[model samples]
Target: MGNILNSVILESILLDEGETLYKQNEASAYDLADDNGYAYHKVAAWVKGKDGTKYIKTASIASRAQLGKVNVSVTGKGAAGLYEIDSEFYTVGENVPDPESIRNNSYCYSEVNNVLVSNAIYRSGFANLDFRLSTGLPLKQYFNNDGELNEATIQKVKNSLKPLAKTAVSENPPIMREHLIYAESLSAFVDWMVDENGEMVNKVSNGVLVVDVGGGTTDISFINSANEIYMPGSDTVKTGVLDVFKKLKQYLSSAYEIDEEHIRVDMLDKALRTNKFTVRGESKDCEGLCNKAKQHVAKRLNNFIDELVTTTLDHIIFVGGGAEALREQLL
Candidate 1:
């Protein structure tokens, strides 16, 4: 056998046309490497190698299933030729009874390539999220052991509060948290753009902003002049879209005594079909139901926004999946 790698054991075998082999009674033995060894003394069929050599070999042989075609070489031949069978199995290590040996080096090459591709895809997805938050600007990326972002990695987190500054606002701003999943990253992105030296930009200081929505939730941020982010309190609210669907389901069940699962399915289907819930039941029309659901979610969001704006010392920013969807409505 060729010089093998470390403690690795190598095996080689050869079989010819129309040959078969089987294993009989064998005793198993285990080594410190946890690899099992077997002893066999019986054979079931005559076998031959590509070189036309015949041998009984060993009975501790396993079956081989054909995956596809491969090329083989014959002893004392000048050119390689294609072989129909995909794979061959052997019972002995290294030295084979046949003079023409089939090199089985392809297996090692394919396994290593698979691992490289999988790791590349995983890292690419993580980088995409960070780029989206930066609004096209490449930002420093950091990941924890669990692949979550560290709060400190967020740039201009305090500046996200700048949206709370406003004079006409009636309610206090909601308190902002820095560690929410996607929402926080988006907030940091906007804050980095609008806040400069702890002050809101002139345009942002006076105008209301509507954030494009996403899949799970919507984020909203508001800002007005006279309120710098660090000056005082600001409110920020994070609300999930799934919560609205759940509330709507509960309302339909309670008001019309309909089955919750059916209502949920219907509501989802209707929302998908019409992009709005406008179905009517014995108690309410689709429009009313959809509006009620949206409004229910909106009410909570508005309340949070109101608190966040009124209490804060700047502008307001809206973000998240829901906010993105309702941007046109708000505009």
Candidate 2:
């Protein structure tokens, strides 16, 4: 009984007014989140045909399939007398968990996308089960502009998850006993600092800044010398490497007269890597343009980071999907 989550860290962090966020709760008494519920994967639609044909995909399978949503109906927000999600259809393709939208405080585990994700995971197991679910918010939103804990948002997360049932190509899967939420960058920091035993490792006793670069937003979390978060230093920036993908698509459109929708994210990534853009089934070198697009977005991210971080910090860690791509350009 040394740490609340001796198992999950590898963690959970909660902070209040002017206090350090590195919390330690009752040891061995923590609710561990199921990895399937919290993993970031390219999920495909769970499709069901009239002849009882069914398809459930997640991770590489979903990414390979290139579909991320399924039409669903959630019934009655089922707690405190309500049943579950509303009985209306949640539009199919509109639920992609875009990083920029999440930073803007518009996404969460309670969303229909998560429900679909949960359902797919549950159905694949084909067994009755109960598990904890965890999610994160952008660093800046986790702590409001005043550096105070955003209780309202936290409560909103808890409230909106009101026991709901979702049907997406299948009946609602009975699972998810608990829901845990934390800040995006802060979660990164905790994972970096602790081990499976919840013991500190790779110690950074002084200020350490954690940067989480995702698809469309970058979240920054900094813990100062006093062991407390420096709120003024934390932020959720709109700049990210995916911006380069969009810019490149636009570049290809102007150069090749191709529709933007016709080019997918995977194609743009390959093009930037190989310096080739395929148009009309022909590959063309576009290295110079690719570098320009990458640099433009990377520079915007660097500018914000330069202003936020100081030389006095003990460490600066860069993580997330965008980190390695922008590493060559970052300070």
Candidate 3:
């Protein structure tokens, strides 16, 4: 067993819908280093005159080509009565060109699988690697009914991922073995109670409520002093940071009469943070627009939080990407 262990590398991957995070066995246990997680995106551009052309390109951060493979497929209409070819790829730090493209059922599987294999291989020093991965599902997604993960649904997710894992692993020099993916939260409860060592931070006989604002959804639940995970019970709202971005996109599209694709994710963020932004050398201000959108989302969140009367609680916690954004408004 020792020899076998030495022969193959072990890796734990957090397969987030919005991001992919992983840590290798060589790293200290529970230590998430800076290089661990990555934003998920694939920027594939169609090559003109190419039909069904596909190739995976790898590169280091210092090198330009690390964006993975460029896949060319005959899709949509082309210029001047010719069938057009389309390709998509992604680079780190760049806003996703089309959020809907990745959110749908058809295009996402390949993107996730390719990135998983590419990232694993990159970490393994381009060697054939056997990976044991760990991932999380949204509390509401896996436990939609009765606040518990359904057995059949869990099995379905696992089974669907297995083949994707195999295909990704085999694509590069590193091949993956078996892997594991699971799902977390109660943000304040996570920090205040759960320690890095998986031990309790403090023992108390009090109830705590946790609210986590995420990218696509916000989850709410409760935990008692006895460490029993309870809820109002647990529930989720469909409002999140992405929703805000979508609304901003809509506003920009209507106001400027520009194609929605031209509005990058970063642009929305910039417009929100700084009231003014420029397009084609023209400066525009969107303070009123962004404020209205923020107010709309805040109202939804406020309504959800208002329904919480689940047992008297000693504390309440708010966390996740959307938490900070809504903090002042929520308070």
Candidate 4:
């Protein structure tokens, strides 16, 4: 085992070629940090290393996603959770691309690259890493509509990822071994279920609802009074922050005559925060238009959340990347 840097338990487990099975564990935030838990954006972009080798760069901060690119090409996101078993490759960038992938496919090198990028960036340049891995799935992807395990999808996800454990992604990628995959939403709940000593807590005596509005998907999950996940009420919705970005980008396109692709993620963020944008070197106010765009997406999300909110829930928690962006409208 290695020292915990992020929220991951870094143990080495070189599996036999035929032994690619994964074991699931309900890990808490304390356990996460004790095991090297590090939070990173789901976005991964392709860039060249010093030796001209291709590498996938993942950013803990959203701005890093477009670090070197003149234009931020939207790719790989929203393709998550419903991975198709095929040989299709998604383009990472239209300019100076990487051959491997930009697709957010857990079953492919893209997933491996994301992990590698994390290890490289957050590891403080410490090399010779030999850590086993653990990842997660959204609520709908982890469970079926009947509240039972999505056996087929889970198995497929694990099986496909097994071979990549030892597969090299970069010239000096971290040494990865076997790994675990947990339910993304449930992982959040486990944080509340454990104490600072990594022991169980008694705080979860009532029902709680978790709303995770992410960049690509919004997951709604419920925990009953018994501290069990109400599978029937747990699901992943397709509406997320990316949709909000689309509406914002659309407004920028139509109102400012700026191409949607050229807006870039960072530029849009600045515009949203300051309610102003630059055109021909002059700052222009877009406060009203920006609010209108966010409100439109928030309205749609409210319609879906209305059905999920009920009188039985004792506490409601809002989370994920998008939650703060639409904070005023959502809360």
Task: State each candidate's clash count.
Answer: 56, 10, 15, 9
Worst 10 residues of 2 by lDDT: 7-16
- The top-ranked prediction according to lDDT is 2
Which sections of candidate 2 miss by over 4 Å?
A: 1-104, 109-127, 163-167, 269-276, 285-287
* Per-residue C-alpha lDDT of model 1 across residues 74-186, encoded as one tens digit per residue: 45322121111113211221112121211122211222111111111111111111111111101112223343443543333324322221111112222222212233333
RMSD of each: 28.1, 12.6, 12.2, 11.5
lDDT of 2 by residue, 1-331 (tens): 1231121112212111232211124331222232221123322223233454443323321211112333223543221111124654332222222211222345544454344344333323311334445556667656778888788887776666564444333344345566677776776677777985788786666689998887657888888766577877878887776688889889888888988878766677778768998878888998877878888888888889889876577788888667766677777
Q: What is the Cα-based lDDT of residue 291 in candidate 1? A: 60
Residues 1-331 of candidate 4: C-alpha lDDT, one tens digit per residue: 1332222213212212232222233231101111111122342223344555544344332212211213322463232111111222222221322122222424222343343334322332212334445556678777777778878877776565433311112223344444566677676677767864789874655578888776667778889888888766666777776676668888888988887767866566678779998976889998887888889988888888777666566667777667777888884
RMSD of 1: 28.1
Which residue pairs does candidate 4 place in steric collision?
6-36, 6-37, 7-32, 7-36, 7-37, 7-38, 8-35, 8-36, 8-37
Find the 10 residues in a row with the least total lDDT in model 4: 28-37
Instruction: Quote the lDDT for 3 in model 3.
Output: 32
**lDDT, candidate 2, at 33:** 31
**Candidate 1 wrongly placed segments (more than 4 Å):** 1-238, 254-257, 263-285, 311-317, 324-331
lDDT for model 3? 0.49
User: Which number leads on TM-score?
Assistant: 2
Whole-model lDDT for model 4 versus the true structure?
Answer: 0.52
lDDT of 3 by residue, 188-211 (tens): 566687775678766546677677
TM-score of each: 0.34, 0.66, 0.61, 0.63
